[model samples]
Target chain A: MKRSLKQFRYETAESLHIALFQIRANKIRSFLTALGVIIGIVAITMMGTAINGIDRGFDKSLAMLGYDVIYVQKSSWSTMGQWWRYRNRADLKTSYTEAINRTIEDNPNSNLLVAVPQMSTYQASVQYRDLTIEQAFALGTSYRYPQTASGDLSSGRFFTPTESAAGTMVAVIGDDIATGLFGEREAVGNIIKMKNSRFRVIGVFRKQGKFLGLFSFDNQVIMPLGAFEKTFGKKGFVTLRVKIRDQKQVDDAKAELLGIMRRIRRLPPQKEADFSINEQKAFKSQLDPIKNGIAAAGIFITGMSLFVGAIGIMNITFVSVKERTREIGLRKALGARRNTILMQFLIESVMICLIGGLIGLVTSFLMTWAIATALPDFPVQFSPALVFASLVVSVATGIISGLAPAVNASRLDPADSLRYE
Target chain B: METSPVITMRDLKRHYSMGEETVKALDGVDLEFLKNDYAAIMGPSGSGKSTLMNIIGCLDTPTSGTYILNGQNVAEMDDDELARVRNREIGFVFQTFNLLPRINCLRNVELPLIYAGVNPREREERATEALNRVGLGDRITHKPTELSGGQIQRVAIARALINNPSIILADEPTGNLDTATSQDIMEIFSDLSKAGNTIILITHEEDIALYTRRIIRLRDGRIESDKKQ
Candidate 1:
């Protein structure tokens, strides 16, 4: 009877069992053989996981800017002090911002909410009584500033739009500014002096975490836009901050604002706007090239390691074939076919690699998990694709290495082999 | 029924060349052995007894001659065909009792059947029966290292019989054993012959040859004598 594929499978299984038996009988040799594959798997898996985590973290940070939000600034991209170049040129002043906001609010499809015009200037050593903080950023914002920025409030209320319109001298202090001025005591409703003017603190914000160890966003203070214009003069440029009814309506609101700005500025048709409208998603798209480069490098390095493991497998299988020559001859003389002999050796090679691959896979998973747990914010998502790829790599390695030995086994002359002694 | 000759060879010439000279290991020898015969091939060193045994066992091809075994022209057959015939029709017991080191006695016996494409369940049943026949059924799970030299040879005999081949060819099956152990193995061979299986043994010892019913003596590459005891 012709041997079915099932029989071949059984034979291969038996051969694998025999191979494992031999390995178990020689423990140190087997471990040394599998070492290269283990190291390769660990390197590839860990690198992939780390890169995935970083990608996730970048996305989460971008999502913080609300997917629906768009910024309309004097110069393209948000950066401090870029308006100086446009200084002599007509800056985005309060009049233009007021005109855009009023037009958008009058439209039937208007989803704009509490549009605020804001500006900032850098100065060092702002003092309160005997205490002085270095390099304080002086922000001039409308009373609706808290609504646009969304800084977490620790205590007291934010300034209203009415307060901003009336040019009130009220301020909403950040956590750091309040602590610096009041020294842990209640700074709410207290008067702090800034730029030779008195401002009353109506609220103190919670901590905004560190930005390169300079000061948190919570370290700043808020005041009515009109109050800043009244005190410092109505000449500074303003960037418009508008909130939509919801995130979904942000695109419509931005379109309406753009149309209003175009009409108010009177740019001819077919002319691009002098200002820039930027989205957080644009920054994320820029990171793609770096991600691809890292992925390619990881694959190349891991492939080299897998190759080394394959070489090890080939070397060991060759040694096994040499050692088992007599036994192989005996089996052939007793009636084994060429394919039978070939499959036996091939199964042995695959078994060796499979064991190594399994160990490597488990070790890589544990390593990635341990590293991710150790470092929280730095992303490391250990994906199953990496694991599956590692397994495929190992199996392919086994097949490549086993090919030579299997051919040698099949090519042995049964007549000569019987007398091989 | 003991009828026709199971093996028939005519002018079998097996020659080997050593650099420049030709050596005829089996020179123009004609021989025949019928079924159910227990025979012995005896000769001194360099007497071509082992060469004749190799041809008869289908392990080697004669240089030139007609070798008809069980009415098939095996001398004309290819290497693969000869291997198939050998696996189907011959059981060989070696001087070293060549059992695979890593496998147990039962697996060793199942090796030949495995190559014959036998199902595992049938292979196991047949192997167990063969092991039982050789008086090593209880020790089937034991490796060769755990067994005595005589027991290993018995396992080898069981392995040879597992496929129920046409003949049991022993090339000095008792060579590695002591006198008592050799006698025990010879007794097994005698019992196998009585049970209707053909037995062909190669040996130089006169006492070992005495156990066979027929003896063929070789001197240099020629048949010196053929006698039934």
Candidate 2:
């Protein structure tokens, strides 16, 4: 048995050498056969990278939403774009924060920590002398706004309680608005015009990239709620930002907030809650179906390419067996076992597939790099797991496609094959 | 002193089915060959010389017969067992000098040793020695395509001798060669036979048959004459 095992090893080594020679001798034919595997591998790895990038990009976006915070607004984020359902509902009031906070302070076991009111619009414009920026997001909130949001002040401090109470015209501008009016220079202490009134920049919030990949969060102009009402009117749009003690208890907090809002709205048990209690989870739920749809389509494209590649490999292997009929007979006469011929052909097909897969991986790497350089916001991730997976897939495809031809070669009658012209 | 026969056969028959007809390639032939015996099998067209050579070489199994090679049951052996018997007991030299064209002389010669489970270093040493014995030592690195027809035939002979088998089966080994090249190959066979190896040649040429000590003539799947030349 040991001797046979050793014999098998030597036979395999010889087979590998022959396979390499054959591939080298017929370079063009081998390359043409490998092309299918190349394209299939490229499609598969690129799709995997895109899916990974989508998942990572979304996680980054969701992180910006502050996991521990929930929003009390008239429109639901999960059911967004169907605005008509909530257009007839009464507008959410900014004072609702005060009521929610009062009830939370009354209960010692409340999951709610604090609530801050935010009233904003996308239509506000900012001006500095001759330069004017339109479509800037202007937000009005209490002094506790930083507690419910993410940007670190790159310049000055947040508005004080005294300033907030006095409805002072001091603003902590976002990074984009700061740089837009001030250019690389300091904007703190400089006055910018917002809707005909001049407000001094107290602090400049750092750059926060995009919000949910849609609009820039750094283009926002934040100020005391009173100053914002004075300029944009008291009735633009309102969202009550409530911070919960534990993110894991967000559902319980949402229920608690729902009960408080219903009592405040004077709603009975028969009616649905007029306002939508929203969170980052609602956005994730909405994004899941779209993500799944892309993933399903990607899998189908990958499967189709690999299937075609397998068929191409199978056809080429059959041709190779036919072309080498006499060689097979000679080997058999030289005392080659049946498995030896099978292994030789299998090795040939597998080597082609492996080489093709490596080339495809390198191609995809370059493509990912180009995409990353061209559009920095668009993510493309190529991971080690993906590399390992494609290689295994390539080998498996080779084996599956090369089996019938290899078996046919192995089973050929030596005498008959020797006479094959 | 007398020794047992190296090959024994009795009523050996090999039949083939072609649709509705049965073609008897070999029919009820019995023969025995002693160790170190050198013989030629000759026949005209439609004769069973080629079929008998195939059966003797263990490339084909006989139907309804008992044939033994070095005391192992060849007729009853399965495919794998026959392969092993061929590897250990028989060496084959074909008429076409069927060397793999892409590989060099040394690798081609080492093909049988590979099947015999020899290690790389030892296989190379033995293949080089065999090539040297065939007067092609310096051309061991030359591929079959790079060599002349006679050189490729010598390389095939080197491959055949690599395993030191009990019998050398040469089926018209010089059929594709010129007269001078055929003389050189026949001379090599003469030397191997003198060195105590059993040799079997299948040929239709009288001159090639004359090179052997005994000639067996076959016609219509049956032996017509066996004479000591």
Candidate 3:
């Protein structure tokens, strides 16, 4: 038999045409065979899209905490594997925060560390003239708090440091809070009552969207720390929010704050400091292992789906070889080489996989869109690299599945094949 | 005999082992065919006519035989070499035509050259020429199912002739065709033979056997008689 790549390609293409025609002829059978592949791809895609969206959401949440800014909290914010242990600790006291503020004030080099106190309650009920909204969260912090609340200033101005120092009763409201307290009217300078204590709204926060059916940053009230302490009586203890000048100095600053707090509290050197220090980056780091686990699971399951698809392709190709035995004999008798036969069938198998994979890829993109719509915080990132990877996988499925059958077809004895019924 | 015989076989034997029994399909057969010879082998069922034809066409190798085809020892040739010889020196036309149903006439005719490693542009040109030679000039784009039985046979013949092989092997070439179509195919065979191509056919039909200049009869896995018209 004359053996050339050109002839092989031509015959391969011709054979693939026949295969497709056969598939088209048995539409229901072909569709049913592809159904498993379709379900697998869609399930994998949807799962992957959802997980990827969450990962992106996590990233956006981190982004809200500016990369250039370094946050210092009383407790280490990372809750990896020991959430209960951290949760059981006694809350850091307000006197510790006052001492930390004094320490930062006294040291010119540490003056970049802005010390602020926080007092928050999630079950607070608010009343605006006639309407009252229950289960609203109220936040009380120093005037410097808005600088850390990146999404907390949608309208009007944050309260000035002078007002906070003097313990003025000014608040920053979230969009939902503003709507509940002031209706459509401008909320700046409006007074809203929380726990029968009235406070003036200075700013309304931007909408931060929803997560798992819960409203986010746009539904809370932000008040100055001094006024919060006066009205709420500073009873539940306070967390010191410290801003560092440079992220590189966070470790040194943390050590300094712990030392100052310990000295002020007059604790012995052997005793554990009564506070924890936290960083936003550490919080993200805590979430990484879970995301990685989810990612690995997705890949493995998706890989199995592709394997199943390959098996389907091989089965179909084998059937095709059986059906075309006479044709194979005729071609051989006409001088088709073994390699030519092999290439033809192999290409046909690959084409089938390519078609299936292409449909899967398109469906995955659509699923990505749905994911983005539902969880806007999640960034469902679809990179060209992923597209390339999927295509490679599909092609690999084709080559691997089609190889044995194509070889079988190529090795067929012309005499036997011609005689095949 | 200044010119060597194109095919020569000595004591050619092919045996199939069916469990504990060995059935001799071709037993100690000796044969020779010169260049441009038009011949036929005739026999009843189980007479080994098909087996003999397979060995002669290089589609099967005889056990314990010295078979020299065109001065090359065919028995010693590997699978690739045998395939090459089959592609370059022999064209086979089955009784059923066996044209691929999905491909058009031209592509069917081009099958031989494809395995022969010809480029596409030349393959198309040569396939077109071969199809036209078989009097299928206009129906080159029509598929096998779209053509008449005689046309499909012609397309098969065109495919067989694509590489301009020295020998054309027809295995019960008219077994599936009606009398008229069979006669039409026989006429094409005569034309091919006249064009200096050696032709060998295996058939049981007396009428089909009579078309060739020579006839060899096989009986019970052995040559019974050989005669020239």
Question: Which predicted model would earn the best DockQ?
Answer: 2
Show the lowest summed lDDT stretch of 10 residues, model 3 chain B. B1-10
**Worst 10 contiguous positions by lDDT, candidate 3 chain A:** A66-75
DockQ for each numbered candidate: 0.49, 0.83, 0.57
Better of 1 and 3 by lDDT: 1
Show where candidate 1 strays beyond 4 Å: A1-6, A74-91, A106-159, A164-273, A415-421, B8-32, B42-87, B117-125, B204-206, B216-229
Prediction 2 global C-alpha lDDT:
0.91
Model 2 chain B weakest lDDT span, ten residues long: B1-10
CAPRI classification of candidate 1: acceptable
Can you rank all candidates by lDDT, best first? 2, 1, 3
The A-chain TM-scores of all the candidates are 0.77, 0.98, 0.86
Off by over 4 Å in 3: A1-27, A66-76, A80-91, A105-112, A210-215, A374-379, B1-3
lDDT of candidate model 1 versus the reference: 0.79
Ordered list by TM-score, greatest first = 2, 3, 1
Query: How much is the lDDT of residue A319 in candidate 2?
Result: 93
lDDT agreement with native, every candidate: 0.79, 0.91, 0.77
Tens digits of lDDT, candidate 1, A193-252:
777778888988887554322335755656777677665566544667766676776677
Model 1 lDDT at residue A231: 57
